[model samples]
Target: MAESDSDSGNLAQVRHVVLVLSGKGGVGKSTMTTELALALRHAGKKVGILDVDLCGPSIPRMLSVGRPEVHQCDGGWVPIYTDSEQTLALMSIGFMLENPDDAVVWRGPKKTALIGQFVTDVAWGELDVLLVDTPPGTSDEHLAVVEKLKKKHHVDGAVLITTPQAVSTGDVRREITFCKKTGIRILGIVENMSGFVCPHCSECSNIFSQGGGEELAKLTASPFLGRVPLDPQLATSLEQGQDFVRLFPHSATYSSITTITQTLLRSLEAA
Candidate 1:
């Protein structure tokens, strides 16, 4: 049997894999990953999140699964189920860390090895989607993940995240190039924190420049997913590990995310 065939045993039950990527940090990349996973869960899909941001694994805190012990079974490592129904599961380097505050100071090869293990070892059983939350920039970790997933399992595509600033969108251009070079399909570009919506009058103010993400998508001929405005309620829900999508159904942020999720689901179905 081929190596890919042998390695396929781990992720054989997973239907689709999506990578959530961004060009720079502090742009809510991991937050987008968590929100997307939750949105998918609300859509009644079994979802798994592989947090590959070794140096800064914040998914655990974001999901409120703090420092849960990871165990290994006969198949492989068992991922932590975030919900009672077990529809949402997650595996992250944060759980393995002795101290969450300690910085992960490691070279490229070690990170690559860990990413490879994450790609092949976690027992993500029968998932409709597995979202790989990556660190910022097109670096060794990105390459390691893309190579392992493409060689062993199928990576459906990547959802690129960006802020509305030129600096952030400029970095995303490099990410677009990186995806093209690696032959990973660009599912769409999401403009996160596009603007801030007032809670009182509900007026949207562009504190940051807007439409850079859409402009980039048009320039590259990639699908423009949607813009997620900056909403305090959304941030509070994420910080408190609450289901914002379900709780704040009438909020603009919830609508934007739901629409984006629908667009992503449609794209996946069409594919």
Candidate 2:
């Protein structure tokens, strides 16, 4: 479902929308979403994150802004802004929970309705790009979001995340099939946790089997974006909700993220 043009086929107001998905968990999918948003913001593009991982929304915590006030206006529900410049905005069901430890115990129909509202009812204002982060597997929420994105938004494509391991890529393969079936264009594959970078001496170590994500991309005929190495500093920044690329411009992980984001931008412009 490659967009014929950005203008004609896009959603009412957004310039582009990218869904960040990984078939399996623990592959740094959420972290990748956070990094890409920061990178896009750094490039001066207006961006927002719609954390559709309903049961476990981490965008607020990862952004370190906490649950913000959702103001009602003449148009609709206004999303929470994370920065002073207001270039970044966020909307998530997690913000609606009464307690952090409480679970999102809802049935299929309810989940779908909430997701639809997040897409159509929320006052996203104007956005250059809206990155949606989903839960690990392709389930009810994935289908609901895909349906809404098809009917309501002009999606740029999907950014699939995976680690360098057969087990992880195997699950991500199913995610690719899900995208194909749903008419969601696949932008590329991001190989996260490709390798480990030693903090003390900056030495590289292949703690996990390498190149599975690249191999998967090759097999699926998708563009191989780039790989993000495992770094302690990057993890700490994610935990602290600090901008890793902003604070660690010279680090390896930052370099990979910047390159991958550049690739996505180029792909979008060409499309």
Candidate 3:
């Protein structure tokens, strides 16, 4: 039997936890998570992206879901399933608050409890992969999720996301260090917004210094997942609450994300 199975019960019974993280914000990490989930679904994987960024949750908007009805189930709250019927469970603090704009002012313990409920109390059923989209910076929420999963639940690995910029790259290094301290495996690094592809000319321009993510991966000894260029069509779709993978499948942006998905599957197989 595999060591993972020997330690984690039946291999088939354990869910693959792929934590999608970024050292800072505005690097398109959440958007990458959304597209990755869609690409995995396209490739026939029962996947779900858990939006844990309480202060600024984007999964609902990415999936075009409005305020979903949440109620007690058995012992806890039930996650809202997307319209695709693929059972993509969503648990975010945005759903529980009385007002969406209200601030989530809590200390470490409260944040930890909320994260615990999100993981244990919610009915995720069975998932092939749970892509956890964490918030920017090493906050209480981020620490809570990593600690809970590492000490309690079975976390398969983590995928770091960053832009091809010096600041983001620097931040990713810290994220890798944090993972090292927590014993969570660093699966790979995704270089998002590596460049901007000009559709009319089919040319790619380095909007941000390119290859920073790959360099970080090399420095940290993690796999370089792939790079996603900045595509305006993607931005437009996102503004209108549409996902590029599902809405613009034939676009260049979608192709970039598809490549990332392929690389991700290969990493999982290698693991």
- The TM-score leader among the candidates is 1
Q: Find the 10 residues in a row with the least total lDDT in model 2.
A: 1-10
- Model 3 deviation from the true structure expressed as Cα RMSD, one decimal place: 2.9
Deviation of model 3 at 120, angstroms: 0.8
Q: In candidate 1, what are the lDDT values of residues 122-179, reduced to their tens digit?
A: 9888899999999999999999999898877878899999999999999999999999
- lDDT leader: 1
lDDT of 3 by residue, 9-52 (tens): 22233367788888999998888888888788778777766788
- Candidate 2 global CA lDDT score: 0.87
> What count of clashes does model 2 give?
1
What ordering of candidates by TM-score runs from best to worst? 1, 2, 3
Every candidate's CA RMSD: 1.7, 2.7, 2.9
On a 0 to 1 TM-score scale, where does candidate 3 land against the true structure? 0.90
Q: Write the per-residue lDDT of candidate 2 for residues 1-271, one digit (tens) a residue.
A: 3333342232456778899999998899889999999999999999989999988788788899887667887657888888989999888887888887789999999999998888777777778889999999999999988878777666778999999999999999999999999887899999999889999998879999789999999999988998998999999998998989899998888889999999999998788
Clashing pairs in 3: none
For model 1, the superposed segments whose C-alpha errors exceed 4 Å read 1-6
Error (Å) of candidate 3 at residue 133 is 1.0
Model 1 quality (TM-score): 0.97
Error of 3 at 253 (Å): 2.2
